[model samples]
Target: MDMATTTSTATHTSLASVTLEVADPEAARRFYGAFGVDTYIRLRASETHSTGFRGFTLALTVSGPATVDGFVAAAVDAGAAVLKPATKSLWGYGGVVQAPDGTIWKIATSAKKDTGPATREIDEVVLLLGVEDVKATKQFYVSRGLSVAKSFGGKYAEFTPGQSSPVKLALYKRHALAKDLGVPADGTGSHRIALGSTAGSFTDPDGFTWEAAAPPAPTPS
Candidate 1:
């Protein structure tokens, strides 16, 4: 079955924010503030206050020095494990943190004015598929009217359909990909990723899954 057809049934929402675990909330806050996110919320648990904020929210995060310490403290107290302690990255005003769930969070202090190169807004979503045989998988996609955009070290390849908005359908070897993601190689089926305009999924050789989907059509303004 062509699983890509099912993406239309999925919800279409713009990515708002993501919350992660922090070892030292205060440190995380400081680090993230320096990176560019502004923290507008903080909660604490104490003897007098057995109850605290019910859920996490980053809607008001911004960048600044004044709120950094508090933000980091709050994050740690809420159960985040620090991955990379706050430090400058080579690319820009940002720091990397691995949350308790193994999600990597990149906190930035300032937007890089000199990104060095101008690129188009992603017209296509890239699906990182895990496969057993790269050549066979490429043939499947090619038969479906997709063409290769590029190949990464001969192991990973990206394919794009001619009629679509230049979105990519990519394939990678399962075991190798799992190692790259630091995840155990036991999972099967596909994981879904959404973009602004289209959606699709790919199943690779070892039964690893990947998806790239575009959002639903927009409503009239």
Candidate 2:
């Protein structure tokens, strides 16, 4: 990878959408629909060889414990496997679920308690990529025009999303991210996700691909 390449042209790059490669788009569609996150992602049918962790996770940030539980329960009822049951933690309450299509999702919130009845509103959708090195990957993205919104040394880094981007991007150490997601760190083959961005096409240091934005489909006259 060309670590020194300047992507000044990509200074305006922002994540436009995320597409998940799955074996069955219909099945994935149903699962995501039932899980209440269908509108947040796109899906394509793929039989690419992949096993274990897949090196990443999509997280949903909600309001409180009730909301966390609400989403987790919906995921479970929708045929998602529970990697971690909803529970209170030092930082907040959350749980992990693996969609039938093999995409892992973490639903969580900073508030430990619910202030009112649970609603299925998602506050944020974050695509967290597990990288070999946080600092190096951070610099790699910076060179590609992504601005750092937050950094925690070699542990984690988050980039500001372009105004129109729906998903927030972040980086985390592979092993640590796996641990947090309650899974093994070892994996191979494709990440099975493609990112649509305004920065043109390029692959990041971690093998995550970013492509130029697709023109919006025309409406019926």
Give the whole-model CA lDDT for all candidates, comma-separated. 0.38, 0.88
lDDT score at residue 102, model 1, on the 0-100 scale: 29
Worst 10-residue stretch by lDDT in candidate 2? 1-10
Model 2, position 200: C-alpha lDDT score: 88
Write the residue-wise lDDT of candidate 2 on 1-221 in tens digits: 22322223445667788989999998888889889997778888899998899999999999999999999999999899999999999999999999998899999999998899999999999999999999899888888778778788788888888787778998999999999999999998999999987878999998998888775434338
Tens-digit lDDT track of model 1 for 82-102 = 433444435333333333322
Assess the local accuracy of residue 89 in candidate 1 as a C-alpha lDDT between 0 and 100.
38
Error of 1 at 174 (Å): 1.4
lDDT of 1 at 42: 24
lDDT of candidate 2 vs native? 0.88
